[model samples]
Target: MRHLCLLVLLAASLAAADPIYVTAFRDPCRAIEVHRLVLANEPVVPLTVVVGGVERQVPAVSVALPRTDWVVHRALVDGLAPATEVTLRFPGTTERVRTLPADLARPLRIATGGDTMHKPEWLAATAKALSARDPDFVVLGGDLAYEDGKNGARVVTWIQTWVASARAPDGRLLPFVSCIGNHEVQGSYGGDITKAPYFYAMLPLGGSATHAIDIGDEVSVILLDSAHTTPIPGPQTAWLAEQLSKRAKRPSIIPIYHYPAWPTVKVSKGEKDPTGNRVSKLIREHWVPLFEAAGVRVVLENDQHTYKRTVPLKGGQPDPGGITYLGDGAWGVDVRRIFPGLTWLAKGAEVRHGYILDIHAGGRIAVTAVDETGKDFDSVDIPAR
Candidate 1:
């Protein structure tokens, strides 16, 4: 079956001289698409891609920032064959992307993390550690750049640093799928989508605050807004219910969003906005039942700078008939202490780490948390239900 994608607004082109970063993903309808964005000074440029020996010149959409020398040229390359190698050439440099196993019958490898901010140095280190895993693609849990999705210069520089540092041991650029977090928007919450210009420019979800992608009929990944730009129980929530209902029979369905439904850090006495309790309450009220009904295998969460795994839970209690929640993102961010002995928690640790998940077609998923030094400190395997 041909891959399906949400239509993207298109404009501009990229050049050979610009620094190129490649990312690949299974689209919303199970097709594999690859994208490359370059930060350059040139205007309206097209580049060439040699895929499995066939070469084609592709157009790019430019996202130009005001008062900056950097112009981001983005190209979405589709109709790709997995398990094969693809190469892109630009005057003095050439980059390569190794595709994942084409057949969904085999194991699929994915790396995930988030909350990368404040320290570009840690971002680099964590990027290297993740790269060593040689992931097919990455899923980030938001908070990409620190404090300013509105600042064009900071956004561009941060993206450049990320692109330059996040590379596999073989030097291939791993593709990433992510949602926006508090850091990606001004005021950190309740901002309109337009407030985060850089995020909208960098990653467009076909004009929606939330979206879902299916991986070869085996797994469905739902990415949510988490009140960053859209409120829960509104349009995004309704859309999520529809999505989950549609994908109910999929072997694995995983949801990723900014705030955790169960946070390991930060208690809320209802004093301020953006507190853990407030965010988690919103999710539990509007989304948890939908998840329970749909049989979502796992939920990936972030915004807390710690690592946590909840016992398979149903309605906030440990139940085998429920969902597993993983995370409290610590990727490149300073670790905060996690109070253990929480009722819903199975494990909790404050560390600088990211998770690698190896999923099989049969529905079993294995997750390993690796530190910045590339050591596996925690591991878990969830057998197929």
Candidate 2:
């Protein structure tokens, strides 16, 4: 009887020490038929990821942090039917993943926010609230983990918290799409890629800071670096123009970046730029024209820690047919005060919130702002462009 009890205790210990703590999905972009899963494990064990009936070996890579127990593994499950569900069997657990529809014939929900993880409890609350809404995927503009380009352990904990609290109502993990923020880098601005080690190590950004993802055939989500690891001008601008030109015909072209080109708060004390904020000047000069030409009706901007929505803007002026910039990223952070009498702002407030974008059939987008309690406070409807 004593030996049997000891064996049972041993089994319990092994169960508690399960290596896989973090599991996240990525790159549900143009590949409607494939899904990518990124897993972080504490032990370096051989993993065979089984999706549907097919099996694939996923090799683990060591995270480039000193004295850390975590390693990263990725698996790509392809040949999936759009809008179908599949079960992924990984070692000791299973996860349900769904693919996006090939066309926008049905409604899809995408939740987006930024400036996350200043406080773990706030992040937990906000993530749980967002999860209850059951978005198909999430796009975080940046400032995730607040690790300041270091502190790998903090990044790990943040991911664990997010995966735990942000699961779908059906217990499936939602795919994550992210862009680089100032907090992701060591120097905070205009630095080399090596400074932001933790961000690149965890995310599958194809080794560059800027990339675009197409949701079905109607919407294109363009994620930019916003001067974190990559600058805003020259090559990045050229690439932005090219990407916009290629997807110019798409009904919705949404750009998600860390800095707001139209800020609700001052960039610095005593700043007097007629453009509102001087920090985002380069983005205004370089990328705004491209956005106007491409007919990008909506843009997602973050990092100011206040809720904001600019009037439909053309050349910094309000126009009926122009782009509407939403956000100054107050997700899971202390809200900031909006500058008084900002002529460009249609609405500005001190609120901790995120956006739920309901993309319906026929290219219409219903944007709803939800607070940490899962309550809707603001909403706007954008017609098909």
Best by TM-score: 1
TM-score for candidate 1: 0.89
Give the alpha carbon lDDT tens digit for every residue of 30-65 in model 1.
Answer: 233333344354555666778768899777677765
Candidate 1 stretches greater than 4 Å from native: 1-17, 24-40, 270-276
Per-candidate TM vs. native?
A: 0.89, 0.88
For model 2, residues 31-78, the per-residue Cα lDDT tens digits are: 221222232333544445545577665554445443344545544444
True-structure lDDT of candidate 1: 0.75
Output the lDDT of residue 168, model 2: 80
User: Weakest 10 consecutive residues, lDDT, candidate 1?
Assistant: 4-13
- All candidates: CA RMSD in angstroms? 7.8, 4.3
